[model samples]
Target: MKILITGGTGLIGRRLTLLLQKKGHQVVYLSRKKENIKDVIVYKWDISAGYIEPEALENIDYIVHLAGAGIADKRWTEERKQEIIDSRIQPIVLLKKYLQEKNNSIKGFISASGISCYGTDTGEARLDEHSLFGDDFLAYCCKLWEEETRNFTPARRTASIRTGVVLSREGGALPKMMLPVKWGVGSSFGDGRQWMSWIHIDDICQLYLQCIEDENITGPFNAVAPAPIRNAAFVATAAKVLKRPFWAPAVPAFVLKLLLGEMSAVLLGGNYIINKRMAEELSFNYQYPELETALQDLLK
Candidate 1:
């Protein structure tokens, strides 16, 4: 199988590319970087203007849409919010148009959606693929991202993975969370009862592979671990794994709001998302279903 990936240089995309290559599948990257990679083909594009290199979409059997400006990279000013949306939407629109114009045949389209689809704070209710969209900036972003992905016509087989917080040592939230713990200043955010749905980096990559190979899997699937954990427990476990003190008082909600502005909502609370479709419908077993095992593998 030949795959075309947008944002192929990003944290998740980089790992996904390597995984596909190891499986003996051909991977082509749709990127602005002109430098040649050893086994991968690089195609250039100007995302803002909605232009892509002609050859990027050629001979592509699958499309993995992961290009987007980091949602937490900047304070959620109105401008930053728009960039986040456009960065995701424009790339898909460009690819869709090209595919339609050339009448190319694509077997499957797998996209990266967020668990934030269920909202910033979901309490104890385990949200699923059929759950209603959360009313917030992140929810709005994921909605639009998946909307474009689902609209890729001529390719009916599409999988929009609503992912949880990815625990990766190389990038994502794990390192940042471990930073303060390493300094003995780590503590939970606010009351620390907020539920956090998470998945290991390896598990997430394997899930994406499952989506590709399983033609029966389609639509929005909650790509989270089997068990959901609270923020306090999450911090406590990280400290234990790193062999650090978990004695700091919980950080006040007001402090987070003041520090991160609208983005503080992500830290102040989160939802408990379930990967029901992955388990029941697809019968895909998770590589790391528990937090301790996943954290130990990454942190220890």
Candidate 2:
């Protein structure tokens, strides 16, 4: 299989590329800069200019669309919000047009969607694929992001992975959480009871590979661990793994609001997301099914 990936330099993309390559799949990465890597092809394209070198589309069998502006990069000002939307929507529009023009023989189009579409803050409800869309900015962004990919239509089999907080040792939430915990300042956010749905990075990559091979898996599937833990529990688990005390009082919501602005809702929010479909249909074997175990392995 010849797979082309956008945002291939990102945490998940970088790891996914290596795994796919190890499995003997030909991977091509779309980038803004040119760099050489073994057993992989890199193509340069300026997505904002609406130009994707024609040759880049040649013999491409699968497309994993992970290009987007980081939601938490800066305060969610109106301008910053638009940047988040454009970074995701523009690439999809370009890819759709490119596929239509080339009449490409692509088998599948796998897009990266977020569980945030379920809502900014979750209640006691365990969000599944059928949950109502949230009215928040993150929800709106994800809705439009997924909708843009739908334009691929009848020609290509499409699957959208509504991913949760991916737990990895290299970067992301784990490291930030670990830093404070290492200093024994680890604490939970808000009331410390909000549910957090997460998955191991390895599980996420495996699911993406499964989507490539499984023809029946289509539409939005939650890519999260089966177990959903409270924010407080997650903090305690991290503390335990680092052998630090988890006795700090929870951070007040007002402090988070002042610090993160609109983005604070992400910290205050909780969702019990379940991978019901993935388990029933795909039978994914998780490498890190428990939170404590995941934290221990990642920290070590």
TM-score versus the correct structure, for each prediction? 0.97, 0.97
User: What is the Cα-based TM-score of model 1?
Assistant: 0.97
After superposition, which runs of candidate 2 have C-alpha atoms over 4 Å from their true positions? none
Candidate 2 lDDT by residue in tens digits, 1-300: 899999998888988998899898989989888889777789988987899877888888889998888888799899999999999889888888887776665888899999999887878987788888899888998899888776676236888899899999888788887788899988999998999999999989999999987878788899999999999999998988888999989999999999999899988998899898898888889999998888878888
For model 2, what is the alpha-carbon lDDT of residue 288? 90
The window of 10 residues in a row where model 2 has the poorest summed lDDT is 148-157
Against the correct fold, how does model 2 do in TM-score? 0.97
Global local distance difference test of model 1: 0.87
**Per-residue alpha-carbon lDDT of model 1 for 67-185, expressed as tens digits?**
88887899999999999888888888888888888988699999998999778887888788888998888888999988888888857688898888998888989899989999988
Question: Which pairs clash inside model 2?
Answer: none
Error of 1 at 152 (Å): 0.6
* Candidate 1: worst-modelled 10 consecutive residues by lDDT: 147-156
Best lDDT among the predictions, by candidate number = 2
